[model samples]
Target: MSNSLQYIFGGPKAWDSGLWTASDDRVRGGSSISHLYTHPTQAKFYGHLDTKTLGGAGFASQRTVGDLALDLSCTEGIKLSLGWDSSDQTFTLNVKDTIPGKREDGRDEAGVSWEYDFKAPENGGEIFMKWDEFKATYRGREVEDPEPLKLNDIKRISLMARSFFDKQDGDFKLYVNWIAAVKKDDNDSDDDGDLKKHALEQRSDPRPVWKRLFCGLL
Candidate 1:
């Protein structure tokens, strides 16, 4: 191993409830809603997902409050530590390279977003996703042969609980211990590296609690 350092994005000691906001299917006349509750040890994401209103299509997610100019160029992948998951439903993790401006009608203009969907772990574990694992998507549909993700300036991040074409719905809950960027080790092969465990212990930091981490942490 090259002994590269892992950069923290959202962790127990760094999570800020105000930094997460619900972005649900309400915009599409659906009732799906989600919330992110920040605790001392982890963050809880739970909500009721309704697909009836949208005719078997609905989604509820928690996204970063604002754009984050994060430079992940030095990192190879993202690491997510799972706490406890009540439902082993499929969830999506999204990263945006650019944020489009709002239209005159006060609605957001659609833009390309990189997304990676994974089945939530039944118990608790960690998942490391490489940059290539994310696919470019627009308005829920994958784009064919899209441009690469801008790793130097990651604009946004989101976690979503969506209805996979009406396959599943109802109440859902997910617990997350942390979200971080892992560096590529030198001994790693061409393929994704070994699934080594990421350190989960939250060490005591002496800095004042700041909600916006990208300002300095990145």
Candidate 2:
């Protein structure tokens, strides 16, 4: 429905539940569970997070069923359109440039992931996640000076609700309308330069565009 947008999900008809599967703490012997209920308008991600099962650490997530093999080189970043009635819980959006093979136990081998954590608006709205906003992480720990995300050949996507060091636990839900890659154009606002107050974007000798933006009045 957008001119400069390319949808990875949320198409013309009902969204497909077959494209996702729960990858929750249950696999790790924890009690948490999650599901993605698909519909024509949106998908609802609902789950119960039981941190006590694993000594106060738990996570619930729904991830793409298989490799996506998307080439997003042209887009500036990813965009998420949140449906109304979405919860205010912090959800992590993850992108993987590669998928590792499974161990003999059938558990996936841990690999680097690009993650962005955001709390959806109470009434739901659009959230843009610029490439610079994503952090390289491995098994939930930040990786310093890691190679930049392999944006061109993104292979997987996942949405997670996790106990942030016991900061959150219990029922959680998020309504997702669509997920797409967005391109900035002549008419677009360049607010991506606003200082997020996170680690500064990887610097280059010539200073990136964000170097010129001020964060005072936003």
Candidate 3:
């Protein structure tokens, strides 16, 4: 019964507020971004952490459109259903092809950061992160033998809740219905004939939304 991996975002034709966007940076101890309702089905991504506000770590981001060819060993990465409220708050799943270099540009920030460490389960439950149990760190060291996670150069995908300046904070909450990029043959059996019909005959371009939004439609 393992055939349920096909969602680009939160579901139900989701696209009411244009995917998402809000990269807060209120000095350091930051908190100022919120979206509580947008539903054809369900969509709620919130942010707030003002340990005092200054400038060093504050986040709220969303980006897409960078599928250079996505195959990552037939994809078996990307799956998030998050929930948080205090527990100090921290959630970052940043995929990159470049977007690093801060500290007021002092050189030393080159991209490659995968982080997943969330806590808000002291009797409350629901926070699952699986992209092969993500924990990659590059440019800061810790990404050894890390390769299988290529949603094709994945330009950008960010969801962050951070407040690192005023030391720590308390008010933070997050919730997402669905988000998937996983494949990894999705429980392969060895018949190799129906990989989505050989990925739709390797698309010779018949214009089904430009072969599902451009990407070697064949």
TM-score of each: 0.81, 0.81, 0.29
- Candidate 2, residue 9: lDDT: 78
lDDT of 2 by residue, 72-143 (tens): 654678889997787767899999999989999999888898999999988889999998999999878899
Query: For candidate 1, lDDT tens digit of each residue in 166-185?
Result: 98799988888888877655
Candidate 2 ranges beyond 4 A from true positions:
1-3, 11-13, 184-218
| lDDT (Cα atoms) of all candidates against the true structure | 0.76, 0.79, 0.51
RMSD of 3: 15.4
Better of 2 and 3 by lDDT: 2
Per-residue error for 76 in candidate 2, Å, reads 0.9
Candidate 3, backbone clash total: 11
Clash statistics: count for each candidate: 0, 0, 11
Listed per candidate, the RMSD to the true structure in angstroms reads 7.8, 10.1, 15.4
lDDT for each residue of candidate 3 in 75-97, tens digit (9 for 90 to 100) = 55666544334343555566654
| Candidate 3 global lDDT | 0.51
